[model samples]
Structure formats: C-alpha cells, structure tokens
Target: MKNILKTVIGIIIIVGIVAIFGLKNKESQDKKDISPNTSSSPSTLTVINNQIQVKNFEGSDFENITEKSIQVNQGSLVKTSSTGRGILESDNETTTIIDKNSEIRVAQSEQNKTKIELESGNLWSRVKKVFGQGEYYQIETNNAVATVRGTNFGTFFSDKQTIFMVSEGDVLAISINPETKKQIGPESTIGAGQKVIIKDGQDPIIEPLTESDKKLEWYVFNQTKTTPTATPRPSPTVSINPTPTEKPSPSPTSSPEPTPTPPEIISVIPKTINVTQGPVNFFVNGQKLKRVTGLFLNDILIKFFTIDEQTIGGTATSELQTGTYDVSVTLFTGEKLTLPEALVINNE
Candidate 1:
C-alpha cells in the first residue's frame, strides 16, 4: 500500500511542475505582445557644420540649435535658414543631413523610425535597410513623399516644386497632393542618378538629372559590400532533327581553332571600398575580375587600388581616417568611371 501511494505522489509532483512552467510561458508571451507600440527608445541630432536653429511649435518656443544633442518628435520647427548644414544621427547608424536652406517640420521620431515634413529647401538622408522590420523613415513635403532606405539620396523643395534623387542606391519618390491628401499616379521607383519632380496640380515626372542640376552633396557608404550575385546562364536546348544528306568529301587542310573570348563582368561592388584597418579581402562580383586598376579617391591617386587580375583582389598598403571621399578608375582604352578609396602608409 505504501509503495502504491509513493508512485501516485510522484506523478502528482510532475504534473504540478509542468503546470507552473506553462503559466510562466504564458506570462512571457503576454509581455512580448505589448512591447512594440509601447516600448521605443529615443534618437538624437548633431550639428556637423555651420549654424542651425530649432523653433518649437509648442507654446511658440524658439532656440538656436547647434553642436549638441537634440531630441526627436518633441515639437515642430517652422523656419529654416538660407545656408546651414546639420546631421540627424540615429542609434542605428542611419544618418540624415539637414542640408542648407531647408525648411522642415518634425512629425514623429522613435527607435528605428522617423517622419518629417520638408516644407521647403533641401535635405539628404541615408538609412540602412533592415529586412523583416515593419518600419520606415520618410521625408514629406508639400508636393511629394520621399521614403528613404537601401540608398543614399536627397530631397529639394524650392521654386514651387519638390525633387528627390538617388545618389548611390535607390529610393521611392511618390507624389501627393498636400491639400487633398491624395496620391498622384504612376509612382516612381527612382534608382541611382535618377530623380522625380512633383509639382502642384500635375502628374509626377521621373527622369535622369543632369550633372549641373544635382546640387545636393551626399555621403555614400558600403558601396563595395552590397551586391546580388548573377544567375547562371541557361544551357542551349538540344533538338532532334532528321540527318542532312551527306555532301561529297573533298581533301581537307588543317584549320586553326578560334581563340576563346574572355568572360565579361556584369555588375560588381567594392566599387566604393572602405578598408577600416589591417588586411581584408577585397571582394568583387563579376566574370573574370581582371583589369580593376587606375583608381582614385578624393582626387588623390591610389596605387593600392591596383589589383591582381587573376585573383581579383589585393592587400592594403596602410591606414585611413574617417571622412567622405570620391573614387574613380580609368580603363585601358581611356574610359573613366568612379572608383574605390585607398590609403597607403609605412608601418615603419
């Protein structure tokens, strides 16, 4: 009888322990369900160059906002200057350059999300793309909406119109009527070097901007890292057909075989490379990555940009600093294209 009772007690204890664990799991899931809308951290803004002022719409407060930390989504600023530059830096490494002569209004800001209204002037932004995240960073204007991500781009509002252009990647520029809050059709997916113009009471125009027309300066990042590999070519389909009639045989001479052509490169990254420090693999994506030389950065000649065509990569010669730079490469045939930055220094 005692043995039977002991067995029954053991079973009851196991059941009790499982019941307690199930209740704890239920409580944990409840907290997770409430976290998204309720828990978001703050973001900040820093002044990089020149002077900038922020005017709070709440109770008509105003202050000259300069080189310091500023909060997001607090209040709106009604005015802007004719010339000044500032950077809105987030914790996620997303940087927004509040360009010179830009009149903007802040709507709301939180962790991994931001919304603003550019009433006039110009502003540039770069936001990293996070897959599977239900969030966006948007810049609005009286004439259009520029949603920024996966690219470096800028928006300009002046002369009764708004223009958004892509510098390194792609950006979505949509036209909206601010007065009616209605969208104007055939939304443009603006790619690198492309732009869209939104004017009042008209259809949006999407086209490539001229070199002289692109005025906003942008800082490009990770140009070498983002590349989608190409798909393999399909094999030629074999078809069965009736054998042709044989022709009369003639005395044949030895003929030379044609030389095979080299494979062509379609698209590649590391087009704008950054070597933080030490030896790193110089990655390239394309068929036969040969002849990747004649490179320049920030108008300075870079010998390290030279590559071993067979291996398609090389080691760096030295260290570098933190700053913006432009790169270019010259072809053997004298054609020139933008290239990667490189720095060379003696360890000794």
Candidate 2:
C-alpha cells in the first residue's frame, strides 16, 4: 500500500511538471508570434497648413512646407484644412490632403506602392499612378475600402459610415459582408462630380456632388490666366531723304578696309539617350521634363531615374556646357539617390 501511494504521488508530480513546461513553451511561442516586425524605411509627410502637426514615432525626421520636405516614421499625424493648406507629395507625386483634425499613419511605402492609413477624421487624396495595376491608395475605416486612383477624392471616417466623395475622378468603394467574409461588389464607378457612401450593412449609394459636398474646386483654382488685351499704338509720319550727292569722291580709300570676317558660331548637336525603366520620366532644373523617354538633350532626368538589372546599358547624357552640375537619380523603388557627377565635353 505504501509503495502504491508513493508511486501515485510520483506520477502526479511528473504530470504537473510536464504540463507546466508545455504551457510555458506554448506561451513563449505565442509571444514571438504576436510581436510585429518593425520596418526601417522612413515615411514622408507634407503639411499644407499651419494647423497640422506630424509626429515621428520612430524618431525618423519629418518635413513641413517651411522645411520643404520631411522624413516621417511609421506612426505620424498631419493636420490641415481650408484656412490652412497641407499637401503631402510623395516621390510619385501622389498628393494627400491632411484635413483638419485628422490622424493618419504612414502605413507603408516602397518602390512600387504607398499606403496611408487614416486612423480617424477626414483626408483628401490625389494619388498618382504607380507602375503597375491595382489599388494605389486605400482609405479604410471600420468596414470599407475606398480604392482611389489618380484623382481628387475626399474621405471621412467617424463613428458612423465611411463617406467618400469623388470631386474629379473615379473611385471604387468596397466593403466586406461580415457574415459571409466575402467582399461585396464595388459601388458603381463614382465618376467626377459624384459621391458614394458605404454603410455597415447596406450597399454603397452613389449620388451627385451638391453645393454643400464640394470640398475641392479643381478647375476654379487650376484655370490658366487670361491673356491681357493690347492697346493699338498710333503710327508716326516719316520723311524720306534724297540720296547723298556723291560726297564720297576720295572715299573708297582702301575699299572700306575689307570687312573683318566674323567668327563662326558653332551649332550644338544634342544627342538623345534612351532610358527605359519599368516606365521612364525625366526632370531638369528641379522641374518635370515631359515625354522624355525617347527625346532630345534638353530633357534630363535631373532628380530621378529608374534603373534595374535590365537598365545597366541605359545611360542619360546632356549636351551641356562643361561645368559642375547637380544631377540626381531617383530609382522607381522610391529611392531618390544621387549619383557622382560626370564631366561633359567642355565648350570653352
């Protein structure tokens, strides 16, 4: 009997130890799985108004209009609005409007994609097209995806439904059906001057932009200045003089000393270098050079270039006067890296 009791006690002790060790191992694994891996690449934000404030959670730098450019970290908030304008321009020219009282996260940005997650409040975006197809900018709330294109769109997230209004282009609003776990159909194309609302359980409703809903007046602000009218000038009367009476008898001395030959003006011939990346763009003098993929020397990708293993042979050269120049190469991977300056043929 004593032996049996001792054996039972020993078994119970072993089981308890094994159970505790197993539980500890499971807890350790769970902790490892739950911790998220942090990213190093810094995000960027542009403040359009004085009302906005950007906080860099990772200690990465951020820029304002005063600074001109800022490097933002993973978590940041930018404020902006009508009285104060804050515009964030990405490497790809995707502009985000940080409206008043908005909290947004610099979610993720890479060579091919950029995502700005709106935690709360309102935001307006004019996302430029990246290289390939798919959603470029997404505004998500409790249950909606406002897939934005290279257009002007406004998004509002409150305790209620996520509201999207398309001021100048198209946007696809998608929502998930909680019970089915399947994505519902996107609301009909919200064309320019349209608005769409995504509620918790109902389908998206599309409507026209009313006076109260018009947030951005793109055409009004972007219209070109009108040409000024010119006043006609009165013509003045002119008198014709008779030819001077052969006063040059002694003239002709030396046939006017044969006119000195003028120096030759060298005509510069510009060479066009073809640069092919996934897609190519050129900038010169801090301004965007249009249609530069296959063109003349004046078109230089001054600040950016997209290069890959396939772009090894591709080169960009300018027929510029020999002097120190500031040249930068921006890879499509969102890397605005500067290259060592190369000397051109000196004209001097």
Candidate 3:
C-alpha cells in the first residue's frame, strides 16, 4: 500500500510542476503580446500648417492636429491639405518638410537612416549628419533614388519624372533605365541653386542657372526687407548768412573715389598620380574611391576601349584582369587629375 502511495505522490508532484511551468510560459507570452516593441530613439514630427491624418496598421486613426510630434511608422502615409505643410524630424535629427498637396510614405524609419518614398508632389529635406557607415537617407521617386548624406535638397515628382534641386548641400542621384535595366551614370554634380531632371525613357538633363531663372536677387531682397520700418524724420532747414554765402562759393574740391581693384583669377591645376599593376589585387584609397564614385571616373566606363581594343576589357562578371591599368582623375570642372599607377586585379 505504501509503495502505491509513493508512486501516486510522485505523479502528483510532476503534474503540479508542469502546470506551474505552463502558466508561467503563457504569462510571458501574454506580456509580449500586450506590449509591442518600439524604438527608444528620440524623434519628432511636426505638422507645420494644416492638420495631418495618421493611420496605423492597428486600425487607429488620428486627425485634427495643427502641430504635434509623434512616433511615425513604416508605410504610414502623411497627407496634407491644400495649405498644409508637415515636417518630419527623424531619430538622427534630419528634418523633412512635406509641402501642400503632397504625399510621402515613410518607407523605412530607423535609428541609422530614414527613407521616405514619395508618391506625388514635393518634399524638402535637410539631413544634419549621417549616423554611421552605410547610413544614408534614400528618397525614392517613381524612377530614381536620391541618396543623401548631409544635404539640403528638394524633390518634386510629377508625371513619372523626378526633379531634384539642391538648395544648400549636395546629393547623389542614381537612376536605372526602365527598359534597359542599366544604371545611368550621373553626369552632373548638383550644387546649391542647381537642378537635375530625370525623365522616364530618357537620359538625365542638367542645366545651369539662367538670368531669368536666378532667384538670388529675390532672396537678397526679401532678407533685407524684413527689418523694422524706420520712423520718418523732418527735413533740416538751412539758414544762410550773406557773409557765409560768399565763402561757400570757394568750398574745397572733393577728392575723387579710388579706382576699384579687379579680382585676380587663380588658375587651378589638377594633380596627377600613376598606377601600375603586377599580378595581385589592390584597392583604391578612400578619398580616391569617393572621387571616382562621385561620377568623376564615369568616363572610364564609357571609354574603356582606348586602353584595350580587344575583348572589351573582359566580361561583365570578370572585368579586365591582366596588364597595366591607368586611372585618370578629373575634377568636376573638367580638369584632369592624375592618379598613381597601381596593379588593380590579376586573374592569371
């Protein structure tokens, strides 16, 4: 009888332990379900003009907000009214403004980078700093990606084309042809007051500032006109004596203004470096890589044949492997900058 009782006690203890563990496991899961994970990084979004509507995947809707900063989510569409302007400040403190009649989708928002996919209309972005390596905010239009590091630029997408204009800083524009699927070389470096247009089924066109299109005068005028109005002053009365009138006729002659000096033109000479290859692999320097990637070396890709007429400098998978390769550096102003000769790659 005692042996049977001992067996029953052991079975009861096991059952109680299993039940306790099951309840604890269910409790932990319930906690997780009740609390969704959210990033603790500090970010803000402000509705600058009209009220903005917010919709979430949990079927939550918020409306009638004049100016409020709240956490935004991916795939959330922030739409503005006719006079509405919304500003989104990312976790990295990047600020972007959505102008009136515009719609922007928060594609990816993270601690490192914040990407906004524009469906239509205009957006002005000012990125303060890049968080880390490989951290960049990508603004995708219908056709291209405007990768920004720390820039102040505006994007306008209409009729399947995107117009990117830099107001203060620079941006790298990358576009892939719709039919050809080949990456289009960005032939232009968009500076402040410069614009680049990317149209579908056509090459990108960059134009300089025209006399009629320049807004520098307007900007200066507006800046100078914002001061407080000056009070009107009464005109000074002049009482002239008969004796002083005689002396005034012999007033001293005023000295002529000094001749204005013309500014000197400084000629810039680009430095050249040479590279030679043996039978090993080598990598370009960081600064050189940045310069090449910035479209300075795009001509090499097009004019690869002048060096090697045969085989087209190797296949797509296997680029030109053997022989000495010379890389020519050039400035944005069409000045030839030289690079040192070094062995790039050797397949043999």
Candidate 4:
C-alpha cells in the first residue's frame, strides 16, 4: 500500500508540471493588449505569400515584400498576386486583412490616425475604440470612405460595386463618385447588423445582412481561420444605371471606365509653426485638400484638426523651431506630393 501511494503521488506531480508548461505555451500564442499594441509601430505582416510588392510614396517599386515591415512607410502600397493573402496591424489599435489579388495603400499611419486605401480587393478591418478627439481609423475605396470609430467591418470592392458590412460596432459610410468627384446619396450610419452597397453615380442600398453573408471569410481576433466552404461569388448582374431616359444600345460592349484625376493642393495657410505652445492650426488652402489623407512636417506626422468641423488642413504636433520644415501631402488616391521647404519659422 505504501508503494502504490508513492506511485500515485509521483504521477500527480508530473501531470501538474506538464499542465503548467501547456498554459504558458497557450499564453505565448495570444496577441497583446490593444492599449500597448496601438502605440508600438506600423503593421507587421503576420501571414504573407510570395507575390507581394511594396511601393514607395512616389508609386515606384520600393521593395519586394516578405513578412518584413522595414521598407514600408507612409504612402507605401502593397500589391498582392492572385494567390496572395496578408494581414497587417498598426500601433493605433487597428488590424487590416488583405485577401487574394488586392491592393492596399497605407496613406497615413501615424500615432494619431491611420488611413488605408483599399484600391481594389477584399479588406477586413478591426478597430478599437476611438481614444482622442480628432483620431480616426479610415478605410477608403474609390467610391466610399468608411470611418471606423470602433468596429469590425469588411469591405469588398470590385469593378462593379463596393460592398460594406459591419459585424460589430458602428461605421459611418459616405458615398462619393470617383469620376465626377462629387458626394452622392445620403450618409449611411451602419450598425452591427447592417450591410450597404455603394456604386458610382448613385445612392447606397441598405439591408440587413443575411446569415450566409456572415459565413463569408472575414478575419476574427485570435481565432483560427475557418475554412470558407463554398461561399457563392457575388454576381454583378445588378444594374447601376439609375437614369430611365437613356435607351439601351444594341451593342454589348461596355463603356470605358473613368480615368481618375489626382487631388491637388495649391497653398498653405500660415505655412509655418512658430508658437512655443498652444494649438497650431496648419491649414492647407487648395482645391482638394478635403481629399488630403496625410500631412507630414519634416517627415514627422501630425493630426488633422477637426475643430469647427473643418475639412481643410488640421493641427501640428508642436510649436515651431527656427528651421524650415518640408511639407508633404498624401492624397486619398495613393499619390504623394511635396511642396519643398514649404513651412518656415522665424524667431527674431
């Protein structure tokens, strides 16, 4: 009886040791807390494939992408091949998932705001709660801009339409025409259970998301990817033509797509920051400063001022030193333009 009791005690000790090690392993696999992760760095690609290229602010080929974030900077573009899929997270409590054959452009990824342009493809965004006054996590396509105050949403953009759905929280979606450069339709405040479709030259369509739509592959936090077993491809048979006066042509050839023009910046208000303290408004005066997604002063990022609901330029990080700072603006179309020592300060 003594020998039997000794063996049982030994087994219990061994099992406890194994269990402790197993728990440690599980903790290692979990992602970090949102509070710290948001202030760390620009996104690192957790999963990636062979056909990824990182392009520079000038749209030049910056580097052939691996699972590395070294060559990626502001206004950098990530282009994926047909079989490519990748996920990236920023220090601002946001995760972006890009799926096969997509293009995602990092417009402005600062500590304050992160703006990504999903030019063409499938993107899943999971954003944490908004912290500051003027902070934003914006995902943009050609025809719509979806601002995620705090939510999980998926956007699928093809040549025909841009589809948006929110699985959690709220998303404010606005519709705009890429060709005509005009805001169309009423703004859509999408709740957790809603889905909306935005196409060019028309208002967005709102409806409740179906159960099958929930089965579509979207990235979930810390969960293993569920295999997408036969999600039916969304057909583009829905008509976009809202005009009834136009007669249909007998030919089946489709009209050519509109070539998008880049947004321009003409001037800057108070082109320098000289005050030692207080709010410094660095407003840019120009044609499409509303489409300006990023502002960098001497390569240091600052937040856009939203006071008085201004759509022009925003605020700077600090009061000015005695040196001239270079001004660079990144438009929503993934184009970056530099004005060359545009900001100057004089302390006499």
Candidate 5:
C-alpha cells in the first residue's frame, strides 16, 4: 500500500507540473500577440536645417533634436521651428518632410502601416508601393484623412481647412465626423497636378494646381532635390594671336536669349476610349501650358484644339489607331513636354 501511494503522488505532481507549464506558455504567447511590435527598428526623424523639437509620450518637456537623426516611436510629437525643416523615414517604405512651423504626431507606426496626424502644419509624403492586402499609408487631420498606396503628395492642415496636393500618383480624400470619429460623406480622388480642399460642413473642392502653387518655397526646395541640374561646361578659351593682329572692333554687347520654360501636360480627361466612340472632347491640364501651340497623340495632332493658361482641349477623332500612346504638347518656342503612356485606345 505504501509503495502504491508513493507512485500515485509522483504521477499527480508530474501532471500538475505539465499543466502549469502549458498555461504559462499560452499566456506568454498571448502577450506576444497582443503587445505592439517592439522588435522592429524604430522610424527616424532627420533634420535638414535649423532645429527641431521632440516631445515623448511619457515626458512633458520638449527636447531639441540636434543629432543628424533620432529614432521616433508611436506617441512622439515632432515640431519644427519657424525656419526648421526635417525628414522622417519610416520602416514601412514611406518618407515624409515636415515643413517649418509645423507639427505632427506619429500615431501608429509599424513595418506594414504608418499613420501620421498633422496637427497644424505642412507635410510632404513620398510613399512606396504597398503590395500587401491590408497595408496602407495615411495622413490625418482633424477633419480629413488622406490615404495613398504609392505616391508623392503634400498636406497642409489648418484650423480653417485641410489641403491635399498630389505631385504624382493619386490620393483618396475622405472627411471625418468630428463627434463620432467616423468617415462621412462621399470620398474625393485627387490626382496628379491637382488639389482638394476640405472645409468644415462642406464637401471637398477639387481644382487644378496652379503655377503659384508649384512655386511655393518648400515645394520648390523639394523639387530641386529630385530634379538634377545640368553642369555647365567650361567656356572655351581663345588664345590671343601673337603680336596684336588686326583687333576687330568690339561687337555691341547683346543680351543672351532667355531660356524657354518647358510646358507640361499632367492630367488628360477621357484617358481611355473605345474605337467605336466617335469623336470625343479631351481636356489636358498642366502648368506652364498656356504657350502650347500644338497637342499630339502619338504623332497625330488633336483636332479643334483650344489652348489656355492651365488647360487645353481638343477632339480626339476615331481615326487614331487602337493602342496606348504618349500625349505631348509643343510650346510656341518649340520646347516640348511629353507624358508617356497617358492615352489608352481600346476596341469595342
């Protein structure tokens, strides 16, 4: 009886040990699944010039970000001085530029999605293509949310309104209900060379981008970084002739001719059409396009053309071949701008 009792107690202790081990393992796994992503590298904020401030979620005092770059996590608030500018590169393949006198919060950041809240300021975001099904990049203000997959865009948020401008690709703009914190009303699509403004109690207003808008100081600064400037070749030196050969009279100094600004066509209405569709009116919108004297699909000219400062349109006849082609515009000065794969022709 004593031997049997000892065996029974030993078995009971073994069973109890196994049960405790299983329970502890399950609890650890549950904590791992529920906790935020702590293993991924944190996003960073880099100062371009001047100074910036960072306020941690647990800290009340704002600390100056003087290093070349500093890691930023969720709940961090970034603010720029009146002349300060900074760049934020997240692990999710998105980069954002914080403009001067602006503030933003890193709401939720992870390897797949990054959400930023623009409290009061201007920001430029460059997002890479997100291939995953649930992956997204978003910028939010109090009244609006701008979501994109892969594109370059700018957002300006103020008390009065929020402006979304797309330099490339597209952005979906949606208004938010203040009290319930849910999306409301119809969504607006803002395309390249276009902007949408969202005001309180009003629908989104879409408009073509203007030259002045493109010339904003921060916009131009970003452009210069992406667009490379050609290096000027050294002027050829002319060796003086031995003994002053007949010195010709100096020709009158004439002013150098001004360089022509290249006109562009960014958006084309009726981007797709079937061959069966007779003639269709197509509108082209862009900057510095007022001087465009001719518009072409492939090599053929559009008929009944009308040109304006920011827009041009004409009838696209059905005689054109059914294939994708470039849309190009020629300025009066002979400079040309071409948008590749802009018009698609289809067969019914």
Candidate 6:
C-alpha cells in the first residue's frame, strides 16, 4: 500500500511540473508575438525647402529637420515652417506634398492602408489606385474626412472648416462632428474639378471648382505634373454662313488659365532681436499686406497687425529662443510670402 501511494504522489508531482512549464512557454510565445517588429521600410520624408520639424511618436519632442531626407515611421508628426515645404513618399508609390505652415501625422501605414491626419494647413496628395478588396487611402481633419482609391486632390483646413478639391479622379468626402465623433451628413462624392467644404455642425457643401479656384497657387503648382492620360479637347464646331438679313452670331471664345501672382517681400524691420528683452514689435514692409491674416516667425505664429496695405506688424513673444528664422505672412485667401533667414535673434 505504501509503494502504491508513493507512485501516485510522484505522478501528481510530475504532472504539476509539466503544467507549470507549459504555462511559462505559452507566456513566452505570447510575449514574442506582441513585441515590436519591423514589418517593412518606413515612409520617406524629404524636405523640399526651408525648415520643418518632426516627432517620431507621441510624448516625443519635435526635432528640427532641414535639407535632407529621412525615414519616418507611423505615428510621426510633421510640422512645416511658414515658408517650408516637404514631400512624403510611401512604399506604395503615393506621394503627398506638405505645404508651409502645415501639420500632419501619419496615423496609420501598412501594406494596403494609409491614413494621414491633417491638423491644419494644406496637403496635396497623389494616391495610387487601390484595387485590393480592403485597400484604402484617407486624409482626415477635425470636421471632415477625404478618402480616395486613386486620385489627385488638395485639402485645406482652417478655422474649423475643411475643404477638398479634386483635380483628377474622385474623392469621398464625409462630414462629422468633432465633438460627438459622429457623421453630420451623408457621404459626398466629389468628382474631378469639383470641391466640397465641410464645416463644423453643418452639412457638407458641394460645388464645382471655380475659375478663381483654379488661379490659386496650389492649383497652378500641380498643373506641371504628368497625368495618366491627356485631357480630351472639345470638338470644334463648323460655322454656317448667315443670311444677309440675319446678324452673325457671336463666336464663343475660350480664355486661358490665369497665372498665380506670387507675393513680394521688400523688407522686414527690426531684423535683429535681443533675446534678453521681454518682447519686441517687428514690422514687415511688403506688397499686398492688407490681406495678411497671419504672420509667423519661423513656425511660431505671433500677434499680427496690419498697419497699412503694404505693412504688417508682429509682436515677438519672450519665449522665442535665440536663432535665425524665416519671416512669413499668410493671406486670408491662402497666399503666402516667406522671407527666408530674415530675422536674427541673439541672447546678448
């Protein structure tokens, strides 16, 4: 009886040990599954001009980036200076242009999905066609979302409103309330040469692209890009001879696309700053300053005042660090003027 009892006790102890080892191995495998892994090459960010800043992820401080290309992972935040521009290229061959004074984040990036969150400013995206069952490319704002399969489009977000202008292909624009995080209206299908605006607490407004809209710098900039197919021209009409008594009908005439007018910066007063001083008022002398809506010293926005049609004043905050920075102004119509390396700030 004692021998039998010893065998049973030994068997129980062996089973317990086996169970403990199994649990530990399973836990180890789980940890391996959850650990971070580099699935693919990160997207590339190339600084086009001026200066930009990037933060790799949440809780990280922004680092200045200039005149170079760098790999950026998902969850990265990119902020451009007043006159800065950058280009982002994804593995799938989609390209996005980040305009000056813009902020964007790579919210999600995967083999078949890409999502960019635009906090403010402008973005021009040329997305590759997604033919897979679940593939998609999207840009989101506080009050709207623009989704495209393959298209060339531009987005502008300001003052709690989002505007989407499609140049080629189509875009799906959806309006949503930022507070409740719910759809405010039905989905809008924006076709080529059309624009849609989504405002807070309002339904999405759809309209065709206007001639003035085409005259904007953003529109003119994209005109140089190559399209998949040449736009078909309208067939010419045959003119019929009018009778002697009838007045000849006026012939229809087509107008050429207007070129965008670039802003001119003549000078910026108080070009040198003393950091020891609490704050200082600086003035910018230039053309077309009356429409100026915002002024930036590098990437920081300061208090702006329009003294006249050709002069703009800005008050620099004491928090400004010692550095040489660009001075730029933005018009209410989204036009911008940047004077690169225009201001020098010193600690002395």
- Compared with the true structure, what per-residue lDDT tens digits does model 4 show for residues 153-199? 88989986888888878988888889764778778899987898998
lDDT per residue as tens, model 1, 132-199: 47677888888788776666777878876988877777777778887886888866788887888889
Q: Whole-model lDDT, candidate 4?
A: 0.66
Of candidate 4, the 10-residue stretch with the lowest lDDT total is: 219-228
lDDT of 3 by residue, 13-57 (tens): 999999999998997774444232364243455654444666543
Question: Candidate 5, after superposition: displacement of residue 40 in Å?
Answer: 6.1
- What ranges in model 6 sit over 4 Å off? 1-41, 225-348
Candidate order by TM-score, decreasing, is 6, 5, 1, 4, 3, 2
Q: In model 1, which residue pairs have backbone atoms overlapping below 3 Å?
A: 224-270, 327-339, 328-339
Give one digit per residue, the lDDT tens place, for model 6 in 1-348: 999999999999999999999999997784453232465347788765446899875334999874357888777889998866677878876778788799998877677577889999999898756646787888999999998988889999999999999998999989988987688879999999999989898999999999999988766554432323344455557576666776665565554444444456666755776646555555576765778888998889887765445456576656888889899988888877899998887765
Minimum summed lDDT over a 10-residue window in model 2 is located at 262-271
Q: Flag regions of model 3 displaced more than 4 Å.
A: 1-43, 58-67, 177-188, 210-348
Ranking by lDDT: 6, 5, 4, 1, 3, 2
74: Cα error in model 4, Å: 1.0
Compared with the true structure, all predictions reach lDDT values of 0.57, 0.50, 0.54, 0.66, 0.75, 0.77
Q: Give Cα distance to truth, residue 106, candidate 2, Å.
A: 1.8
Clashes of 2: 13
Best by TM-score: 6
Q: In candidate 2, residue 232 scores what lDDT?
A: 46
Candidate scoring better on TM-score of 1 and 5: 5
How far residue 173's Cα lies from its native spot in candidate 4, in Å, is: 0.4
Q: State model 2's lDDT.
A: 0.50
Question: For model 2, what is the alpha-carbon lDDT of residue 66?
Answer: 48
| Highest lDDT scorer | 6
